[model samples]
Target: MSVYHRPVSNIWWLKRKPYILFMIRELTSVFVAGYCIFLLVLVYKLTQGADAYGNFMVALKLPSSVALHLISLAFVLYHTITWFNLTPKILVLYRGEERIHQGLVAGTFYAVWAVISFMVVWLVLGV
Candidate 1:
């Protein structure tokens, strides 16, 4: 009988900076998904009644909930930035015979993200 060896180590992803960042980016989705569920719960609370919604708002104001939100926010920002950085690889642009620079591609994504974010804020605030 032949013994099989495991191909991967638990710390394999931490061997390099890029690998560590990639793992973190992938992990961020969990927090993002949790936040989405949290938002859905908030909406459900709103549907229940003003009192439920008020209770949810108060719960969100608790220090533990605030810390969780702040941590989730950090993960979300890291995920967004890393995703934007990788956009150039997935989105190829050619102008005539020449391919566009990667920096330009990432810059364009960042610009579009900023514009869309501003638009969302403007609409939300009615400003």
Candidate 2:
């Protein structure tokens, strides 16, 4: 007996709203990873001494680089928001036999994100 295999269409994910959003979230992860690699390269350039690091910073200030960073930031933000929303489902916390509210769970994550972001900004600004 031969096994029957179902053929999947390339645009199958586009058939539904949830599927489309899920695919986009997964796609954004690539941009996030690319940004991480970009940071690693930045660190490597910094270790190469002042001139190399200065040149890297100069390139980053270009319009094309700025646009790419903005686009990546948007995707990364979406990826983060969706993941945070899903955390409540993945992690169910019980409080004295009663389950904690999903909003509170997600809100806690957002609060932590805000605090960390503030800290980073403060450090970057030397304030």
Instruction: Name the top TM-score candidate.
Output: 2
TM-score per candidate: 0.85, 0.90
> What are the clash counts of all predictions, listed in order?
0, 0
lDDT of each: 0.93, 0.96
Q: Over 4 Å off in model 1, which ranges?
A: 1-7
Q: What does candidate 2's lDDT look like per residue over 2-29, in tens digits?
A: 9999999999999999999999999998
Candidate 1 clashing pairs? none
Worst 10 residues of 2 by lDDT: 118-127
The digit string of per-residue lDDT tens for model 1 on 35-85 reads: 999989988998999998998989988999999999999999998899888
Model 2 pairs in collision: none
Model 1 weakest 10-residue run by lDDT: 52-61
Cα deviation of 96 in candidate 2 (Å)?
2.5
